[model samples]
Every structure is written in structure tokens, then in C-alpha cells.
Target: MKDAAFNQLTHARRYFEAKSAVYDENARGWYGRLTDALLSQALDLSVFSRLPDGFRFLDVGGGAGRWTERIATANPESSGVLLDVSPGMVRHAERRATRCGYAHRVRHINGDVDEAGELLAGMTFDLIINTHHLLGFFHSPDLVLGSIVPLLTDHGLMVSVLPSRWHAAFGDLSVGDAERARRSLSGLSWEAHEAPYGHLFTPGEVRMLHTSSKLTVDLLTGFPCLIYPDPPGVASPSAESAEDFLRDDTFFREVLAMETELLIDPDAGARGANLFVVASRVQPAEA
Candidate 1:
């Protein structure tokens, strides 16, 4: 019999496979665009600017190569690998990379992160990107991190964006009462949203996880600190309508600027729907 972790991974792979055809279209709405902007800016400020020439990078659980493509395009001299458990996602990423002219710079692998040790044997990278709450799906995230950290060069970086419990408690989508939200958050277990399952973490939990893996946290930030839930009687927009809403550049830019400001405030920043972390592998001290 398959273990729970294996079963969850199988479900996740199937979920992403079914959604691969509509993934890009579904991800272009206002929220997705804003999140992408925030992530890109964070990468520029932290990782991309400091990368050495001919750097090697890896994208774990990179669906459709969205973030991988961005990194590849930004660093044309750098080569990288895109790994995902879903074959459909891997295929889409390969096709996109080819069309975007970065095909030669990136290799797509259809494999699981849990098996990184065997799947990526004898390979290491200068940087690794894991986002969209990739760690939360794993049965033992610590083991997953252990596998990944060894793949990084000394002082190498791993950038991740994960769901935050604080965000769910305080953001616009919250239940509007802190204690109640906390109670609700505590009861969550592998709930499915867009994917097969997800888990949320606190900022402190995230820090502890990295530190335990011998990685030092370099930066942590939360996005969209202020969230305004839709008013009563307002209907949620469909995918097409949401995309149309994002077409207004002026409105979009203004909202993003507001989020940028709020994201800097420690108290308010912790209320974002996601937490962005930049962690570096610690080098051993010279004897």
C-alpha cells in the first residue's frame, strides 16, 4: 500500500495535470498579476542582482515554468533545471521555454521533490526557487528541505513563497475576529484549494524550519497587507471578468504601490496572504 505522502503526491500530480491547459489563463487575473509583480521585485532586490555569471539555478515544483522562465530570461547566461512531479506541467514548461527562446538554458524534469536525492544525484545549484506553498504539501517538509539544502552550493540561496496563517487570520479574507480566526486556522489540515492539499505556516515556523536545516534566513516579507473583502451583495468575478479588471493599468499600479508600502510595515506586513523568504546555506567556519 502507498503511504499517505505518496498518495497526496499522486493526487497533486493529477490535479496539476488536469489544470495545465488552463493554468496560464487562470493565473493572469488581478491577484495573480499582483503576486507575480511582488515576487519579481523581491527576486530582483535579493537574488538576481547578486548572482554570479554562469550561475546554475533550480526550480522545485515549478508548474508551467512561470517563475523559472522569468529567472532564465533575466539571466541569459545562466542555465537551470525545472523539476515538477506532473508530466503535463513539465511538458508545458518545456514548450513555453522553447517558445520564449530559453529552451537551451533550462531542462525540465518530471520528478518528485521527495526524491530529489536520487533524481538529482551529483547535481548542485547556486540558487533554488520554490514557491506556491510547495513545502506545505509534503508529509515531512523537513526531509524535503534536507534533500534540497545539500543540492545548493555553499552560501547558495533558496527563495520560497508560502501560505501564512497570520495572513488568513488578519487579511481581508479573514473571519474578522482574531481569536476566532486563530481557532479556525488551528483546525486546518491538508485542505484542497487549487491544488490537492495545502498547509499554512507562521513566520516564526518558517524561520525555525530554515534554521534547523542549517540555512540562515536573509529576508522575509509579506505582501498585500491590506485586504478589503468584497462588499455584501457583490458577486465575485469570473476568470474572464477578473482578467478584464486587471487591464486597467492605472488601478493596478496604484493598488500594487499601496501593497508595497504596507508590506514594509512589520505589523501590517505580517497580514499578507503569503510570506516570501530568502534563505542562504551557511558555510562552515574555517578551522
Candidate 2:
């Protein structure tokens, strides 16, 4: 399964680079019709309240620098690092950072999250973020998290976005669509197929992965917050439509937002497409 998944990511990266132009164009279209839905909600601000001014943030498995841009844009005073395992994607992110006016506040690094090397070694941040359904990159998220203790500043918050165990819809595939996507995913990049399709972590699983003496869950809930892709690999929407779609339809935006609220509420019945986790560093428990 690991090998299958890795090859999937490799394929996804190649596919994206081959079609980056079209992919970026179509994504702008989708977001044009749907950005409002994706942006309506806010993070539980408490996570940032305790964070000192001019906070520093590290985006784990962060590529295309999209999430880093968002965070930097939302918090202008913040400086950020866009870390990813893909050099090509890192370059894409660098371009995006320049375009988004976050070039000065951001740095891009290409490396695996599991490696505690010079790139990430001795670095600490007030905030950490991992988005686009990235929790599956590690076969053992707990251990992946264990290594983070030394890299987090006091009161640091780690926000990880992952696919919800219970979500609104699974594309309602007709006949073989689901199977087709499943098979197509096997040869895609891990970034493309990691979450929103390939692997789903339940709320329980979310709690478990980040459970540590170093931190405690500040928030864990389902959010249809992202109209992005299920398996975010080569299959994700293009940048153009991503911007275009959300801007085009109010009803489309409203419903996704309304649905997200329900998924986060206690009686949400099930879950949504993904879970948003905000965990804070905690002092170790007594021995």
C-alpha cells in the first residue's frame, strides 16, 4: 500500500507539471464560483490569541504555497515557511508567493516531513499548518508528531487539515466513476491522492494522531470548508476555475457553508469531507 501510494504521488506530480497551465486556469474558475463558501468560516481565534505578535508559522507538506499565502495574507505580520516534499511544487509555490504579495514573508523548503534534518532542525514556530488533506503522508502520524515537540515554540498551535470520516457527498459517482478515481489515484502523486479521496481519518483518528504530552486538541470538527479536490493530486481543479467558481454562485457558496456548520455541530449526524484540527503545545504531564 505504501509503494502504491508513493507511485500515485509521483504520477500526480508529473501530471500536474505537464498540465500546470490548464490546471491553474480551471482552478480559478472553480474558486470564482465557490470561494465565499471556503472563506466564510474563521479559525477558532483562541488558537492565535495567545500567540505573540508577529507570529511565525510553518506550513507542513505545504506546496504551491497556497495555504501559506492565505495565512500570511490573513495575518500580514506573520512570516512563514512553505515546506514540501516536491521541488517542482515548491517552485510553483514560490511563484505563487510572489504573485500573492507574500514573497518577503515566506520561505520555501523541499523535504520530507519525517526527516529531522537541517531544513527543519532547530526551527520553531508560533503556528504550524498542514492542509489539503495531508495527514496520510505518514504511516504513523503519532511518531511524525512526536518529532515536532522540539520544533514548536511555547504556546504554538499546529493546525492540520484532513478528510472527514463523515462528509457531505462522495461525488455520487455513476457506475464506475468511483472505481476509476480509485484506480487513477494509484498512479498519482501523494499530494494529489493523500486526502479527500485516498485515505480518510475519522474524528477519533484525528484525536489520536495528534494526541501527545506536548499538546492538546483545541478544535476538531468537520468542515466542507474547502471546495478543493478529494484526492488533491493531479485530479484537483485548476487554479483559474478555483477562483472563478466560488465567485460565480451565491447559492453554491451558501449551501456548502451551511452544510459545514451542520457537520461541526454536535448533532451533525455524520461528518463532512474533512476535519480541521488545531492543537496547542502543552507542558508535559508529571511523571
TM-score for each prediction? 0.85, 0.70
Clashes of each: 0, 55
Q: Rate the local accuracy (lDDT) of all candidates.
A: 0.74, 0.59
Best candidate, lDDT-wise?
1
lDDT of 1 by residue, 130-231 (tens): 976787776556556776898998857888888776555443233245554554376243332345444567778878889889998888878755543332
Per-residue alpha-carbon lDDT of candidate 2 for residues 41-126, written as tens digits (9 for 90 to 100): 53533355666779999887776776677778878898978877667778888888888888998889877665534677777898
Candidate 1's C-alpha runs over 4 A off are 1-7, 169-184, 190-192, 228-247, 262-269
TM-score for model 2?
A: 0.70
Q: Which ten residues in a row have the lowest lDDT in candidate 2?
A: 187-196
